[model samples]
Target: MIKKITIFLLLVALAAAAGYGYVTKQVEQYIAQPLNIEQEQIFTLKSGTGFNRVLSQLTEKGIIVGSDFSKLVRRFHPELTQLKAGTYLLEPNTTLAQTLELLKSGKEHQFAITFVEGSTFKEWRQALETAEYLEHEMSGLSEAEIAQKLGLEHDKLEGLMLAETYHYTFGTSDLDILKRASSKLQAILDEQWQQRQEDLPLKTPYEALILASIIEKETAVEEERERVASVFVNRLNKRMRLQTDPTVIYGMGDKYDGNIRKKDLRTPTPYNTYTIFGLPPTPIAMPGEASIAAALNPEASNYLYFVASGKGGHVFSKSLAEHNRAVRAYLKQLRSNQ
Candidate 1:
């Protein structure tokens, strides 16, 4: 009786081991399947969030098929401890293994550091100081040195970098960042220059950029960019000076103290269009993509000038006489409203 009981117990133990192995294989197979679909989704995990909380959130969001499966896999693999907290965009059909790999590698998502249209060099300098990718502070880089490093003929890079988000790899150099941005801007300029409207007064691509920079400063509204571009285009066609206040501000540089006095316009500098008959020697601020496009393809209008309408946009005119009248009306309106 004892021998029979011993044999029976041994058989039961073998059967239990076989069942466990089979169940473990099935669980592994289930966890390895792709969790993502065709659509892209953004997931953010805050610091100090527990693994179970993350799993629950993913499960709720339908990214994970089963919370239990994810939990099991995570428990089995303790090496995935390098996951950093940040926003992640999971592309379609990403496998669980791939996601696990991403977390394990601790690759933080890359984001663009945007330099908005019409931002001055001072603003650009501050932005660079804040961004994590730049090793040297903005103060360390002079315009001439940065230009030399980026292969630019002009010393100023503020208005030339082109406002856009650029993807950066880990450990990207400042020179490389400048190179990529400048290259994109160059391409846009070339394309626009080639397809430029007939009889346009733009002498060169640099001249076009200068005009674009002015247009960028003139308006923030998308609809108004073309109209604003038309005003400058008309002025250029008629050989009139682009007496933009921003140009005077650029020329004033450090002396501009939050106020544009009557004397500031008289102060002659390279960027002062009032002093210079043509476009400035360089751009005053970085132009966005739309501004560049608008500069190249200005609206066909008789508008030769514009002034702030005090409505967050510009009021355009076909001639100086009309422009002066509009300016008077707008300024009066502005004073009354204030």
Candidate 2:
């Protein structure tokens, strides 16, 4: 009976050893074997999102072996608990060790989005919506709400967000993105303001931004920016109204269709430069570096009027007589074409 009891104890010990060995082998295999997931698969892990979801997603995509190994590794290294959200490039042949290292390192994917020089807030909203990183609809968020989210002051986020190609992870928040863009803009503007030429008409940096917005809308030609800026400078110096078409468009607000009708110009609003204007209350569009510079250093010219010459550029005039003649010439040309 004693011998039988000894044999049973030995059998139980052997069974226990076998189970331990099997677990060890499985773990080793998991570490050495490469994950056979397809290439070109993108995984987006959002901020504050848990590891369990990542594991489940990996399992679903067949990127990892099983939940057991994933759970074990996660428990072992609880410090790697948080993952920064981004678009990750996935590979099928990634080893378990390599994957774990990647998770621990928190390497975020980098991509770029450019806000053009003259883009409006509405245009910016559309651009953000189309970006891969920004998931939230910009349409729902008010400018003030967006500014608050981005830690900006109330009522003016329109020109605050700079025009530049910014790098961010796919999961970057619109708020954070806007903040970075604004910071870059502020830096650029500060530098430009410090180096600005003396005796210019602009009162402050904000005023410079306002005038820059005007210059940006006046023409698309790079060489013409400084020249157009001079026209506005002359008007401001003489206390004459700017009478810019874009200002009227701003005043019209929703009423402005694609075309600026004759009545729209005649209609009165604070932004209608044809009636009342020193500078518009705010920027009409985000101006780029060149426009800002033009505002700071306007080209020397006596010209106060510019009418489109139908050549995708304008003909400048120093007096009302020259302006009327140019206008007549343009009008005649338009009529002839029609």
Candidate 3:
């Protein structure tokens, strides 16, 4: 009878050992093997999100091999507790170990927003408002208040922010975005101002900024920017009216109907370059660093006029007669298209 009891005890101990080994092997496998996922996945771990919640998320993705054992395994291993919050770009079919390693690193999830050049402050605000994962706080504040909140020197938000793709973590505020853009703009503006050409009509960096905004609206072609700047500078030097239509549209403000007319040019407003002598009262849009550089260092040219070439560019001319010919050609092209 004693021998029978000993045999039964040995059998129970063996079964327990086998179960332990199997669980250990599965835990090791869960920690090592990559899942059968395809494509990069975007996983968001919100602030204060629990590690168990993270485990469940992995289970949902079929990444956890032994889901029941994982809870026990993690409970025994406390080092997997800490987690960071943001939008993580996860590689597909990544190992459970690799994913956890990334989450713990606190640098995996970063998002970006690209502020386009020639975008107005209103448009910039709208973009910030629409961006996912960004906390919107600027929507309620007035533009002037926003400028103040950002600690900017400008009275208004227009032309103060830089145009660039800004990278930030999730839950970042729109104000933070504005602050980064404004700071970048100021830094670039300072550097460009220091490197400006001699005898340029622009008295201050702000004046050059105003001109840069106008140049940004003029053309998108990289090579044409300096020539476009030259035409404006030449016109400014000769006391000729800057008949640029962008300024006229800016002057029209909300009244603009997406079409410029002969009557709009005749009407006088603070932003009307055709009516106003020099630079506009304020920048009409965000000017990139290149546009700012072009405004400060325009090429030496006799160009006094420019008209649309009807080929996604402008035809420049030195004299009024040549300018008139280009204008007539533009009108003829328009009439033909009609």
On lDDT, the leading prediction is 3
Please report the TM-score between candidate 1 and the true structure. 0.70
The TM-scores, one per candidate, come to 0.70, 0.73, 0.88
**Can you write out model 2's per-residue Cα lDDT over 182-234, one digit (the tens) per residue?**
88878878888988878887888888888888888889999999899999999
lDDT of 1 by residue, 278-318 (tens): 88888888887788888888899988888888878778887
lDDT by residue (tens digit), candidate 3, 242-279: 88999999889899999998889999999998888988
Tell me the spans in candidate 2 whose CA falls farther than 4 Å from its real position.
1-39, 45-59, 62-87, 91-105, 135-141, 148-154, 332-338
Better of 1 and 3 by TM-score: 3
Q: How far is each candidate from the true structure, as Cα RMSD in Å?
A: 7.6, 5.8, 2.9
- TM-score sort, best first: 3, 2, 1
